[model samples]
Target: MEEFNWLQLLNPEFYILLELGGVKIGLFVVLFIVFAETGLLAGFFLPGDSLLFLAGIYSEGLMNQFSTHNDFLNVTIFALLVSLMGILGNMTSYWFGAKSGGYLYSRQDSFFYKKKYLYQSKEFFEKYGSKAIVFARFLPVVRTFAPVIAGIVEMDKKKFMLYNILGSLLWSFSMIFSGHYLHAFFLNEFGVDLKHYIEYIVIIIVLFTTVPVLWKILKKQAHIEE
Candidate 1:
């Protein structure tokens, strides 16, 4: 049997094609991926922002496969569902942290578990408080661990929920809808089909979001050495 290439699953292009092909299973796959990325510690490596954006771009294709009419309403509904999935994923993460965070924190780092990630997440949560949940949504690794940190810190549930909902809505709507509309604008204005540029676009988006986090880490390390 051939080994399953988990790396291929991380590529947004894989999900983009599935979504564009109107594979009904694509919807569930996308939702499951979003949920696991935010909710599971093992999911830190999964693509989040890029997948959302690509889903937006190919949303019309997915809709057209199901509905006879192409309209903005379908896109809006799809974005809403995606946003809700993100929120639920964070909520699940929060619950897991609330349940087992202390036990995990007490253990030594192992091959599969790194205590440093939790420490970094703890510092981020302490520095930003409830706002970290919102800001982390735009960040890559931080977003995956922020909810767990919040739970570990025993942040108020009601407050966490408020920020979680706000962050998920903003992150999901902005990425997905922007991709959907931007694809339309580029095609209509410059007669350029954005699909051909999806790989480049995804790279740019990943770098745009990731560079700030790297810079902050570097600056903090430098300050520590000083």
Candidate 2:
């Protein structure tokens, strides 16, 4: 028997999400994370972007999640369900923002919620116009609050839903499919298993998703100082 390393405990796919939840319920964990990341203000900490990617590797195209045996069928069903969660999550966030926009603006920051993120996402939405809805889906913190900003502004429902659906599908499908096919390519062609380097993969994904946001903040501060 191989000894389990505690460090791998930090890797959700390697230990927590998949092992704890197993195939039967792991899919729900994935869906909930996706929903929360976009829908809840405090859900900004959720590793939604990376989870989608990792799901492809561990979920095996979510075959069991949707009760499908065919390869294409499984992928389609899994992607759609994931997208639905994202869409619904955005709608929930938007609704919350619409109802409590003033209170949110006055609320104090805490461990889970930050007003800066809201302001930053507002700037992003203002700068990008309606397209921010799509761009935010890939960016971590921005995605959490972009819909909120949209809602606060009272964006047209039809327009918001249009971009929301497009953004959710593109983000979910791209991440999952890339993870699925890319993992297979590496394993089959080069014989490298991503699971072996889960920690490094997590670090890389985190950096890829977050560094840009930090950099932009730093650059804006520099401009202010100038």
Candidate 3:
């Protein structure tokens, strides 16, 4: 894993091979990744926002990689498709929680599994409601766990999906097209090019998202000791 770009694992070439290997893998990787991020307990570290943003940016370079159409229209279509994939993934995760999270919360469960990660998310949902879905979509770690927690805590499915779709659309497309278009706009504006700006943009997004999480963590710790 250290030797791999890991990030490139999400590239179109990788997806083509996933298809060739008989996975019927039409955006399923993106689907699963988003689902795991939203629903699975330990998936918060996965790069949901950055990945979508970068996927949009890389689609132009990957036209030949997947032997697909090279135009922005095709790229936009693909990005939107995957954005829907991500939303559906979260819905599946919600379904998973609705189906099984109850059992995990019942008397048969052990303390570690019952008292740890799952309950934290449950508390977050209990405290926030539908607003949690929107706010959590922007937060990295909590975003991954929020929707599933929403399901486990018995959030209204219709309302959850509504918020999930809205947030996913904005989060996925805004970052993706903004990076793609803005990078192009800036490069074309300068005499030559400023391609390295993409890396800066990603850093800014990550730091911008992560700071609040860090703040919340520190705030909670301080309250605990007081």
- Choose the strongest candidate by lDDT: 2
Q: How far out, in Å, is residue 64 in model 3?
A: 5.0
Q: After superposition on all CA atoms, what RMSD does each candidate show versus the true structure?
A: 3.0, 2.9, 5.1
Candidate 1's C-alpha runs over 4 A off are 1-7, 19-24, 64-70, 106-113
lDDT of 3 at 133: 77
Cα lDDT, all candidates? 0.82, 0.82, 0.64
Instruction: Name the candidate, 1 or 2, with the larger lDDT value.
Output: 2
For candidate 3, write residues 1-226 as lDDT tens digits.
2255777553433432245443345355555666667555435555666665655555565343454564677667666776676687678768877777766566353421334445556666778888777767667666656777777778888899898888777777776687567657766787533344545655777778888767877798899999
What lDDT does candidate 1 reach at residue 95? 91
Better of 1 and 3 by lDDT: 1
* TM-score for predicted model 1 compared with the true structure: 0.89
Better of 2 and 3 by TM-score: 2
lDDT of 2 by residue, 34-77 (tens): 88887776456677777778887776634564566776567667
Model 2 earns a TM-score of: 0.90
Angstrom error at residue 111, model 1: 7.4
| TM-score per candidate | 0.89, 0.90, 0.73
Count of clashing pairs, candidate 3: 0
